[model samples]
Target: MERQVSNRYRLIEPLGEGGMGVVWRAYDELLDRTVAIKEVRYTGVGDDKRADLNRRTIREARAAGRLDHPSVIVIHDVVEEDGRPWIVMQLIRSRSLAEVIREHGPLPVAQAALIGGRVLDALRAAHATGVLHRDVKPENVLLADDGRVVLTDFGIASLEAEAGLTATGGLVGTPAYMPPERLNGEPARPESDLWSLGATLYAAVEGVPPFKRDSWAATVAAVLRDLPGQPVRAGVLGPVIMGLLQRDPAARMSADEAAHLLRAAASEPAPYGYAAPPAPPPGPAGSWSDMTGPGERGPAGTVSLRARRRGWFLGVPAAVLAVAALGTGGWYVVTTSQSATTPTPAPTSTSTPAPSRATASPTATPEASTTPTTPRLPAGWRRLANSAGQFSIGIPQGWQAKKSPTRDSITVTGPGTPGMLLVEWTVPDKPVADPARAWVELEKEIQAKGEFAGYERIGIRSTTYLGRPAADWEFTRQRGGTLIHVINRGFRTADGRHYALYWDTTDARWDQDRHYFDQFVKTFRPE
Candidate 1:
């Protein structure tokens, strides 16, 4: 905040602001390059306080610099000038995994596993160097634009351990993502990092924290005593969640085992691109390619230009939705077609104006466009509502919602596999708001009545429905190419509390009809 702090690093734009300090995208005149400068905010304290704070800052940077792993975000320098401490580090250009999953739902299994494995790898490196990350969450793990995972916010918490850096009794990490040991006041260690990683993976797959509460005290209670509703059964990840939530720190899986399991999970289909590099890193001759420069030869003496041009086609299925709205910005859709050959793009139309945010003109000046806006939806597609029964939400107009053959639910056919939408409404005489209890009963009921077996609950959260509170759950099962999307909303009417439940799948050529399905869910608000 002070101009010319130490008179060498010139502050530019602020990158991020946190309780401890403000991170600025700064220019280092001495180094003649751009770097991230973190300036500490000292409380109203005297000289003795400032010196102690500076010492801790140096210690953190020094400890982090000792780690020599690609997975860890590099910390370049730590400088103390005029009673304040500043840290210079590499600037990562990527959105946090937290931001990605927030815009979408849970990540596909591959991406989650890939991210989890890398975080564990980073943890191993930090522990090997006699240091703990102390904080591990989606926000701290960045998926760089270059498709690499970088662990950040290391050892910064230690700076706050000094009296001058932060106020006493301040919570240093994200609450829902904090491991139980951290809540219990135990010093962070390798096991603590494991716990945080587990929480992060859980949040990544479940689309929310494993343990959540509306109030702070309630959250603490949930973390200490509550069992999270089984997460969306992400095939192999189910067992991993069980291991991560172990109350006793010693009972949890080690970073080594977790990483190994993640690699194994990468083989299964879910969402997100977390698959390990191909047998030869997508290069020729079955060896890692050296596609380093603009015009250099890659593996097998092939021109690197070939690989660079083909990068967009790799692992990207056909029919991808790339749509932009005024206020909502961009959203993607992945759809599968009827022939099951070509993948359909997800619906990304921004036709419905965003009432919550401002909108820009359809065509902004090209010269003024520095950041590229996501493309608009293709012509002629219309959004519709999901009208199966009491479950009425928006959907694509032409897609058909038909009753399931089993007579228990209705399936809405879209253009692709990811495009199909299913809704089923079930009424229970006695309704319960707790997801764990509801899951146990629902599992038993589905097993007994539904045609499908092997049904498993993933994660559940308490949310409001139609102006009243309700519970939502995600499940995984053998749907014979059909993925069941179910929701149970409890409403108190003249007949007492009752539940509205439904299930759907993307088994059909789902992409043709996916835009409407996602929009239906996104706009679904009980009136």
Candidate 2:
């Protein structure tokens, strides 16, 4: 939008879209500078709730603003626009780690370890200040064009010693990258993040997350029960991945240990003629060695000058909050001493706990980069042809598809998932020639009814789908505990029947699960 918000930040162009909100490359009219503006378009909540969330967003921004580490993204200001909060931040021209993997394939082993180590440095600094970055995934890790591996999105972070906002028993975090304890709804410790870092590194080298599955529920089960498929590509770092991916949080590898392991695996020579520092002994002694400044060394080993100057990751894992529950939107995070509220989930299958899984068996075939750009069906997905011979679509195996004939739609539901895919068709009021405007009226209908709360129309635009004129509407809504992202696409066939496909995914799995919708569109055939 050319229209300015708060009389200062003017929207330039969308940099990215997510379940939370859209980030725009913006212009600051007052200062004549470029910045990134995040519009928090939360809808459906009451006035009081919105006000609380607004206050919390400001608090979170202030917390992040206090962090002066080089790897943390800087927050500039918080503004109120249209009764919602907007966060203005430093706009680093960068690509996410996820994007890098998608384009270049898996990184070389040493390079992956080095990146992971740098990220650990940032996390250590954040932990030192009592900030728990509750969400740590590849998407949150930014690889700046300038070689800066910055960690962004503390929107869902928990400040230690504060009341957590999440209701008891609610789940948080992206399931695939979450630690085992967090997946079971237990609190996440710093080691939990280390586990996520390990998973991220696993994906960095092996191409897919350690616990990926077709549905969120199964993914959660896998995280809790199954060991990640062994990684042949991990090479020297394979043992490190296994150490960090420990099923028991209490038994998980410490950040310093993991970092040291990464450094050893990195094996690149230090510019100042030193090797990676040894895993410090547990106590104040080793902690100081890690925090020592340029050219400092422990009594036994020499620390790198760069590591000393750059403040390398603390080998000792700091004890932070184990679990973070949100208040409304994830941006408003709260902390708890323990994350014991997660219900004990049933076993996934007959698989035993895989503490020694990587060493125990041969690696399974690795899944490719999970960026979800192509139309190919992932393994284990099934194709279903409509009984009426109208079309066929790919769906995750075991998901139940039910027809709602009166609504002219078919809905697919996973066993324990709230996400859904809906396909609907109806005879147009008359012979509709152009599909572009066919669904514009429906978009207007939704806009008028205020059907979406925190409703920001990402956009409603005309496009071509499979050589047929089509219109697509992308928008986000916040409903109670769930932040929902929706893609609604309408297609007009030559037979005068208008068909629409609607895909809904929760913010937690939005990036990972949206691919199925694409596969559906690719596989759809109009007969």
Candidate 3:
């Protein structure tokens, strides 16, 4: 491999490795200076995903390079060499706060407040620049040898106009330090960063994060449930930490309020009584917030609860968990929940070839409910035909039908539900492959990601559909204490291509949604 990059910077010794890429302390021969170069290499990613990674990398560099603050690391140059992005940044000699904690336990109250204050300054600058440091943790906090603090690693950061790589995919960022809503599939927000900052400071003061647990599932549960134990060691900074750690971003301490408190806490002496936050009443772990009005929509972060649930770096691809958002269709659809062991699926149903085109009525009539075999449509439902004319089906009223650009799929969505109907099909030049094993393969990958809670396979088996080989799978996902259910039916067509009809909805509404799902499946036509 070539060591010289951009025909100027020469690679020297390495600095560290992270999920996005590796940082190296290099020499910029052209500029006659030493610099930190971050190399983001997408090694075995598919073509479909490679473009996304490139976009995300360039966005990250641009986001970080725009910030002009002493506490924010300076970006010297950004060059694309070998189809990989190399970000040249200022070399800061320092130790991560994580190192400091491991070597000497938590910092003193004043010192922790001081460090947090400086980080807040960096955050303020980044926010002003329209940059969100999505991955803010102790390891990203650098304590320079010459008395300076800097925030590093804007890898998964989000900018004003750019959607995060994992925006619609699986959860991103460290679950342990991530805000609750993001874990529940919400978008990253400035307040979410604040919650992470609170978690970092809490660790600085208590040696352990307030919600540390033995496993990912347990950790997320703790974040959504337990309030941080009143910091016995936080002294004057205790209340400030709690305020920043508020579970709801809307109610969480504002940037100005938090900055003021941190500055004061840095100079204050230890105060006496520490008030414990009230333990939440046991019920559902997640609560609905920021209810949307008719046509207006909210950002993905509205699903957030207050707890600062953060996770470490997870190099995950675009995954479809709550629904069948993965793999174009075929069989990659699923829902999740927390379960100690995988449950055995019930017996398989007999095969039945469905009609190519069936009648669709725009009514939520419950014609057949005694048996799930003959599913009925919800009242006021209407028929939606794809613009490509590849297929058509009945959709519930208010549900929008969107034709994907590829002419191979359509997604039906509604405002009231978090689920959708996904249709995927392909014209094939080869023989059809087994459809049942596609779900099996998806299950393997989903389990391998291992970042889910309430991930339980409800059912799966081989079945015939529309005069072709077909398979069906159902599951539930309960992340951050909210339950979602998924149902997918995929089958091979005479042309060797596969088609799948996927549906997802909240678990609480599964019974109602399933009826709607049945009408669409029964009336689906592959023209």
Give the per-residue lDDT digits (tens) of candidate 1, residues 106-162. 876655775776677677767766777778988788765334467887745442233
Cα shift from native, residue 511, model 2 (Å): 57
Error of 2 at 509 (Å): 60
Query: Counting only residues 3 or more apart in sequence or on different chains, how many pairs clash (N, Cα, C under 3 Å) in candidate 2?
Result: 16
User: What TM-score does each of the candidates earn?
Assistant: 0.51, 0.51, 0.50
lDDT of 2 by residue, 30-140 (tens): 977678887776566678766766666667667777776546787888888788778888876556778767766786665576567667877887787777787788888
Native-referenced Cα lDDT, model 1: 0.50
Task: Please provide, for model 3 over 413-506, each residue's C-alpha lDDT reduced to its tens digit, 9 standing for 90 to 100.
Answer: 8877677787754211111123444455556666777744667777665554444335566777774467777777765333222356778788
Measure candidate 3: CA RMSD.
25.2
Q: Which model is ahead, 1 or 3, in terms of TM-score?
A: 1
Native-structure RMSD, model 1: 21.4
Output the worst ten-in-a-row residue range by lDDT, candidate 1: 299-308
lDDT of all predictions, in order shown? Answer: 0.50, 0.58, 0.60
